[model samples]
Target: MAPIVQGTGEVIVIMGVSGAGKTTIGNLLAEAAKCTFLDADDFHPDSNKEKMREGIPLSEEDRMPWLQGLCDALKERIIAGKITVLACSALRKRYREILRLSDPDHLPGRHNCSVKFVLLNVPVEVLSDRVNNRLANGEHFMPPSLLQSQLELLEIDVSEGILQVDATQNPSVIVKTIGDSLIQTKASESY
Candidate 1:
């Protein structure tokens, strides 16, 4: 089956705490949707990566530029007419707002671009196990010790236009659920 095509100017953010399979699921979602996949990690500065490696949670000041960079990249893709999927640990509502808003200096009329967030909800035990395994395998820079800090900062509000899914499910199944929901959402919005 063809992947569900997102509406024009829409950017999808696969968001959750660490070990919620953001990268894995985001890549699959982008591939299925025939869009570009962007990992928020790639946009992080060396200092941010080092802090995370040392098990330090970043302060909002440390994250501001990183969020702005992601925002710029999303804006570029949107202006170029490409659907982009980003995997990010947008753990707080304020952080998500930063992503959704365009830098007024750069794009004056594009405040709060169309963004859909997919929050991957997983049990704490499962999330811990995943983090431990990922660290053991040296798959990512985020240390397992920082997972608690991330969860503590996570804000899951329904008003944020989030589609919550069980992260423990098969990746394909999860992707299908997101795709189906997007389709229905778009269909309703058209009416």
Candidate 2:
């Protein structure tokens, strides 16, 4: 809990479809690590929010700019040597790549930033229930109807080095799992 990877320009991305508790888990992890926490939804343009509010699925074209902005923001934090935890629905391999800042063609310089992705893998039924509950409480703009589309678009590749956590567990458990994994990963890399 004492700053997981301080001054190491580490970016931890908590990813999954809506209702997977990305924001909640990400916030808790960041707090435990004593770092910055960011919710990707806040970066969405008003148009995108409106579309989701209307139960419309956004296309790849609709997401590129937003993703790019997130990448830029993350890059800045990395350069500043800040540890940042981002909660985002980085459902696609391409989107994850962008967030990783792995595209040499677009990168301004060699950034020694370490980006770790944690996927919150939850059961569809649980996701549905969570989304529905949020909808009923008017707590979010994303309607429950868009969940299916998000699930369909989700693509995970083992080669991405993503850490998958069973999201059905309690939020604290999920955070501890991720934190332990990250610590182990960092330790291994030091060799």
Candidate 3:
């Protein structure tokens, strides 16, 4: 790994459809930021995992508790002033909003740490191939059959503080791009 890039209290959510390299890229970004890496999938209940393993797409009702748990976990770290990289599907704007607005009572911008989203943009073919490979190796819980559903749910807008990157790029290159982008954005914000 290259020298770690120093970072402030920031929560970076690596997001996209299944097989978009969210976990791989998020881990690398966490390493570059010298912070902890978290996989949102880990927070999923056994039932949720089973649903995905069975090629079932989770409904919004099935996701609320899970999303809330992730929000609480992020709040815990942010309040402690720790930087973190989390890989979450967060396919809908409401989901991302849940991840963003840590405290309902307080203004969105007054959170202890900033939440930035990184969307991995990959072609459908490439995503399918990656998911297939992972399934073939018994390395992932998400069934390749659900990729289309995830893609359908994905709502992206780079204008909304979501940094978009090519998922087909090397992990190192992806990490560097996200790191540089965050640094540049933060610098400009301070101006």
Candidate 4:
């Protein structure tokens, strides 16, 4: 991991399982902070998407390259002095570490940023229902079958600048709760 020149902005990771509302919360956080919003899914290669499309769950090996992509994107934006809020499925501690360290492509301006991870958690039933509804839309490549693997891989590192929120809660409530936490953490100092 390459340390950034100087830390100028915060990197908030909205993380959780597929239906945990990471996208919504991350987008809201980005809007409130007036920073760039990045969807981690966009970094996935067609092959990975194809795997998911075929209902084959992605292993950690499958995710490392994608995680590296995230690191690169975050590293680039951090170097350019642009704050970014990312929605990712950083399930394990290793995954989190890789991102925080900007592994693989540890650029010059990668590690010089404050990082906060927010986990959106909900009951499995709630998540299952959400995934079902999402699938009903017939657009996402993520299969409901992959949800179990994500749940199993998830390791809640609550002390690593991680905050936990109930995903099944209303969107406004979730956003407000997270916004308040961001303020309390001084992550929104520029806001």
lDDT of each: 0.85, 0.88, 0.84, 0.78
Model 3 C-alpha lDDT per residue in residues 81-120, reported as the tens digit of each score:
6778899999998898899865334355443337888899
Segments of candidate 2 deviating more than 4 angstroms: 102-113
User: Per-candidate TM vs. native?
Assistant: 0.92, 0.93, 0.91, 0.85
TM-score of 1: 0.92
Candidate 4 structure quality by residue, lDDT tens digits, 1-191: 11222346557899999999988888877777677899999999999999998989887788989998888788777666666789998999878887786423343333333666889989999888888888899857788899898898899754465789988888878877887776765634545
Candidates' RMSD to native:
3.0, 2.8, 2.6, 5.6
Candidate 4 residues lying further than 4 Å off, grouped into runs, are 1-7, 103-113, 187-191
Q: Alpha carbon lDDT of residue 123, candidate 2? A: 95
Q: Write the per-residue lDDT of candidate 2 for residues 17-114, one digit (tens) a residue.
A: 99999999999999999999999999999999999999999988889999999999998887787889999999998887788783223343223337
- Model 2 error, position 73 (Å): 0.2
| Pick by lDDT: 1 or 4, better one | 1
Model 3: runs farther than 4 Å from truth? 1-8, 103-113
Best by TM-score: 2
Order of the predicted models by lDDT, top scorer first: 2, 1, 3, 4
